[model samples]
Target: MGEFNLPVKQGYGENQKTSCIKCVLWGKVAEAYAPNIKKGDLLVVSGEFYVEEWVSDSGKRLQPTIIVNQIQLAKKSGDKQGQAAPTQPKATEPPVDFDNDLNIPF
Candidate 1:
């Protein structure tokens, strides 16, 4: 599995709040798309949402997570509707080593 942080914005003006959601992608989807995702790139994702709860030295913690089933690059603000986002060139080597376990501190 591969995971990334997605920033979400809600409400407007004075009431606006921004949150960072943890998204997890598994198997083929992670291998195919994870390498191409970059910071500042807008993405559309569909998945199951839930809160993962755990306890740490500090205290109990809750993390909102998404199990991404489908994901796609979203069109830029200047692009016309129905137009696809530009694709990045395929890399000769994988950008991340997914075979090893990630050292994520929970």
Candidate 2:
């Protein structure tokens, strides 16, 4: 599995500003629906909408940036579409090539 870099956000008391790394995993597909992603460790990204928001200080002014969602991993393969949440392996297993490189003389 590839490495996923997630942002960390903290809330400032009494501040109405949205100081959080809000992101959506999935909302269009039926199997996947994540309206608001919060600060948690349950983010299992598999073709999931990966986004991060941060403030950049430019010339003594705070600039807010909104990045589009990124799919870290593509949709998993299965009997049906949108089946990446499950942990079951593929139905058909490919043959192993452990000894394929061995050259035996007759």
Candidate 3:
């Protein structure tokens, strides 16, 4: 089993506050789902939320966690499966003179 911190947003616009929630991914689900998740990528996660309380030598601690049942990458409104997301154009000029700009005068 592996753990991940998911950032949650509260409210909207200027009132938005972000918080990290602990999530646990395990077994075949983790192996398959983890790879596709990228940093800052939106995800749709469904699971059970629980808190674990324990007493240690010094004090008591409570840990909040989500036992993940399903995880999927959240797609933009126009995104379609098996199709590449639209990318911005890399400059308005042609690529023929690209090497000339990188000659580095060194």
Predicted model with the maximum lDDT:
1
TM-score of every candidate relative to the true structure: 0.71, 0.20, 0.59
lDDT of 1 by residue, 12-92 (tens): 999999999999977665777788788988887767688999999999999999876667677677676656675443544
In candidate 3, stretches whose alpha carbon ends up further than 4 angstroms from where it belongs are 54-61, 76-106
Instruction: Quantify all predictions' global Cα lDDT against the true fold.
Output: 0.74, 0.32, 0.63
Candidate numbers sorted by TM-score from highest down: 1, 3, 2
Instruction: For model 3, name the residue pairs that clash.
Output: none
lDDT of 2 by residue, 1-106 (tens): 1132345445677753444333322222211222223333334333323333455564343323222223223235453675555342232322222234222231
Candidate 1 residue 102 Cα shift, in angstroms, is 19
Name the regions of candidate 2 deviating beyond 4 angstroms.
1-19, 25-31, 35-41, 45-106
Tell me how many residue pairs clash in candidate 1.
0
State the TM-score for model 2: 0.20
Model 1 scores a TM of: 0.71
User: What RMSD does each model have against the real structure?
Assistant: 6.5, 15.5, 17.2
Report how far off residue 89 is in candidate 3 (Å). 26
lDDT, model 3: 0.63
Candidate 1 C-alpha error for residue 69, in Å: 0.8
